[model samples]
Target: MISYNIFTLTNGLRVIHIPNNSDVAYCGFAVDAGTRDESENQEGMAHFVEHMIFKGTEKRHAWHILNRMERVGGELNAYTNKEETVVYSSFLKEDFERAAELLTDIVFHSTFPQQEIEKEVEVILDEIQSYKDDPSELIFDDFEELLFPSHPLGKNILGKPELLRKFKSNNAKEFTSKLYRTTNMIFFVQGNIDIKKVKRVIGKLTNDIPLLPTYKIRCKPLPYLPIKKILSKETHQAHIMIGSRGYDAYNDKRTGLYLLNNMLGGPGMNSRLNVSLREKRGLVYNVEANLTSYTDTGVFCIYFGCDIHDIDRCISITEKELKKLRDNKLSSSQLDAAKKQIIGQIGVASDNFENNALDISKSFLHYNKVEQPESIFKRIELLNSETLLDVANEMFSEDYLSTLIYK
Candidate 1:
């Protein structure tokens, strides 16, 4: 069992602390701002700021930050997504305070030094170039642009190269000042620790954050169209992605969608997509589907790669199977298997330190409280064949946006 509590600090920062009996300690700050909050010209500033935060802070150099944490056997990292930016650290329970202070310092005190910012910009540019080289990454980004043509949801998290070229030290500093304010941040700590102490530390750390304009931005819906895009790339296999908009992260029906995704392609060995496409017909090398849940909107996608000659056949077969789920009845045994798979995955997630943080923190952000993990199990257990069919029909409903990219 986990003991947890949450409180709003005097500075308007919400902090959630989860206490474990184990020796490992982990903490993170989830900032409720990301690409969706960016201006058209500042597309990837959230991600860029995450990189820049580690470059240097007002009191410590980059190497000093690394060395100090390393001395205590602590690990620190940060990441930016479409809706949030998370900076996290892990260390022995004895080193929790040091780890927390270092994380807070980097995120709250980054100076965005002129020399370091120049070097980091080049690094991000090269990272963007590297993604362009990887067809899998490029195709998904293309699929998103294809699916949501006019929305920021479609924009790449890595801001466009041309816009990034114009960014300098001052631009990053200004953006960070505006984006990383205290009101938009939530501090989360999970491990063997005192709840009162956790609250005290966070309150003390964020007390002086300067006030700024609200960071929350309402996510706009995607304009789905019956359009197809094919990018010509010289590669051995054609990487194809088919996707459409789906439900929001907080939607009640998401659990059903999770079960549906598993039945379609995520049941591992027994999944229909893999069994029929890869094993029976042998038309493609591999097949998979994903439901990416986000703050205000979500996406359901099926992706695969095949020999150039097999592209058309692969797409046709994939569509047929997707439609089949809508048209056919799911047997009780099949539904049971999918439920088991999802439950097992959730069970694994329950014990994971980082994922536990993700599960609780995400629930708090989305539902305004952490959902008991058992509640999910009970929901899945109650899923009958009839309910399964209903969910499948609703998920693969008539409205869908598709994107395809090939060599």
Candidate 2:
């Protein structure tokens, strides 16, 4: 079992630390602000600000910020999602203070220079174009837009080019000043450093963070009507996505659905979808199921790319598999095997220290505490066939599912 420490700073920023004997350390900031937090006018401002953050700080130029950790054989990176943004680093344990201090400087004191905004916007625009060229990846964004309709949750994290060109430094500053707050951020560290030293270092660096009032409110998406969409595109293969909104982060049924997704189309080659589409019938090269849950909503989707001629057959087989899960409970042995498989997967994943730190940070961000591996294993162990059956019936029924295909 991995042990961790959690504490709150005087300014309301929360911190979590995991101690280990490794020479390398991982640390970062996970903020509760993301694409969904943006106003319609600010379509991709969250992600835009994330890029600009590295461009410069009040005291450091883009070059200085980029090299701060690298010069010492370390790395810095950041990413934005639907409901969260993370800026983190991995470096030698001796450079823990350097990493923490640099994270604070960029996240809190970014200058968002006008020249950087212009350059980064072009880069982001090119990125948007690259996605357009890959129908398989672009289909997922189109699917979500179809799933949520007019909601902000449906907006692509990469905003439209017309809007992207109009973004200025003021836009980034406005977005950050409004959403980035001490109360909405969590600082996380993982290394062999002493807990007291971690707290003291973070406390001094973050002491200037104002305890701003919370003004952010995430409105849950309204009920969605299922729709089937087939868009014509110039591609040799058909990329399809079939999914429905699943449980939120706080829902109890999420655990069962997670288990069900793993069995259906997880990363393992033996997953049902992989075996059916790739091994048994030789229909496609890749098939996988994904579940992405937010604070108040979630997305459960299955994606596959296949020869255009095989589209109908693949959909038929997919539906057949869903029906079987809804109609019959897993046998006692099957359930036991699934529980063991997922438990073992979780154990393997926990061994990745970088991902483990980020995972625990997210857990703490949502629940105000980190759940141990044993706790998660217990949840999986408690899942019975009835629970899985019910989850399948509720979430995987044909009526609740929506289909999006790129042909």
Candidate 3:
């Protein structure tokens, strides 16, 4: 039910705006570059650049960048993933120009001073250490390493400390110059602003960016091999992850798998995994399923933390649930209920203007158009129980699924 506008600047940066009556505005850039784009030697450069971007720019110091929006009661933030990097902000609607200009400055004009790089690397090293301390969290990265094997997609987004220390300002600048082309970026805004004004503001500032040719091509991961691994770690509870390579973003069956994943172990308390593992049996504290689909491949995983004594029981129960989905089609009432649950969840999530803005930016970046909620709902509605069963059988087959455990 949301509406938006999109246009391309002469510099090739695409812009999208979602009209709303809210007093707060959300704006940012979604660059079609991320961890996977880095060369082997580059390692953590993408994420390092994200942190240093706000440290200093041509016109502003780190302190100035931090206070520019806060002085106006706004917030700025950015994150990098396997395939994309997003820099965004939330501020009062009237300060749209201020937020947009600041985002532009940080993304394109950041100086990435050595002082900032040295300080930030220490911070990130601490972050990497903290991540290692949490098995439940670190297990996901290990699971991805198993899924993608030696490929860049499998490497942790937080690069190694040794490589991180070697990164210089020139390395970051070169990476950005090579990958962050105007054609590979999208400026997204959500608020009560006019699209024409957004076009004018972004167009004038970005006009100086030379039109550059797109040169990045992502190499897909090798054929998946189902591998089972258990690593010993000192922890109070055993963490388990089991899943397989799944349908990519472009697959027609992706929607069906999404619904199936929701019914099995989504956030809802009534999910089959939660009901069977937690509410009924009291076997574990939490259980959840996650599906991450990228440009050319996807990862579908279920993670649960349980006592060492309960690990086998938990795995058996999880496999049993997967078997149920693969062996039996949902009844009409069950299918309808599953569809409603996910649709309602999506509807609730769409109310967050910030997330919606970021989502549309990525959508436009990948698919070149924003799909309305109604459109997504229609696709979900078109999915049938047989389709869900087929996807479950294919994606959840024992031969395809891999298991990783931290004990």
Candidate 4:
């Protein structure tokens, strides 16, 4: 039973509160600005701006902010994604207002100092280097590039090093001023607390924040290129990712796709991609299919890692397994197993306070509704073999497929 309330401030900020029946709470501050908002030269500005928010606020220095938060044993962190940026805190219910003040101050009154900008730029440069050193992360970047091509969405969230070099303190402030507005942000707080009080506090902090300008995100349509696989010779085991476009977050068939993804390659062990390829043939190490949904678009991807010499055979087997899924419906027994797996996962996630908080936040942020666990379970339970088949056809359709291999 997740009950919540939403309040819209005069400044245009939308504050949401979900009070749980537990002692601990999770608070999340999400902005609707992310990588998609970056200009061509400012690729990754949203993510860079995220790092700057913690540098200093009007009253609190970076170290002071952490010290104060830690004194109360509160957990504070922030992240930037393709469509949003978020600063989050988790603490006992007693520390909620304190945590909120610190978070709001950092987000609203950051004083992007020149020295701090230079220092954080180098830090972000190191972070980019770290990602480059890891083949798994690097190759995913490659896959996204191939999927989106010239679009800003195709660009890495960690803007290119050359572009980072061009970023000055003024640019950081400009980006922040333009994107981090009351209209562009959504605040979410969940725990055992008074929703009315939370709303009042948020309303005070955001009273003067202005609306964001109307800017259209331009993502030109990219045609499905030919299925070409590139092998990198420097790696040990072969890492592969195949993908194509899929539906936005609100698609009705999303629940069906969830079940179909399980049947294909999901959960811990009882999945077709793992069962057939790893258990029976003993050919591959691990394989899974996953989907990423956004506001305007989405992507469905299948990834696997195997021995370099077995790459061809791995690809053949993977394609065979996927084609089999598209060609045949799940058996009644298989359908039942997938439903049980989904229901069990939902139950486990909801039983805990923190997990349930995140689940509700994800619902409000992505799907715009707090879908009940039982409702989702009912959808999974009632869906049959035919629904799974239809989902498979929609997701695994061959019109726009791509594969990228890192040796």
lDDT string, candidate 2, 1-407, tens digits: 87888898878898999999999999999999999998988999999999999999899999999999999999998999898999999999999999999999999999899998889999999999999998888888899999899898999999878888898888888889887888888999999899999989999998888888658978889987889999999799999999999899999999999999999999899999999999999999999999999888889999999999999999999998899999999999999999999999988888898999899889988889988888999999999999999999999999999999988
Give candidate 4 regions above 4 Å deviation: 211-220
For residues 146-235, write the lDDT of model 3, one tens digit per residue: 999888899899899999999999998999988878888888999999888898899988888899987897898999999999999978
lDDT of 1 by residue, 23-45 (tens): 98888778877887887788888
| lDDT per residue (tens digit) for residues 1-407 in model 4 | 56788777777777778876667777867877788888888897888888988888879788887776789888888888788788888888888888888888888888877788889999999999999888777877778778778876677999889898788878888877877777666788888889877977777766666665635455654664636568665887788987776677778777787777766788668677798779988878778888777766677778888888888887787788778878988788777777888788767767777666665666676555688776877777888788777777766766567889988
Clashing pairs in 2: none
Query: lDDT of candidate 3?
Result: 0.92
**Per-model TM-score on C-alpha atoms:** 0.94, 0.98, 0.99, 0.94
Task: Return the clash pairs for model 3, or none.
Answer: none
The TM-score obtained by model 1 is 0.94
Candidate 3, residue 6: the lDDT equals 81
| Winner on lDDT (1 vs 2) | 2
> RMSD (Cα, Å) of candidate 1?
1.9
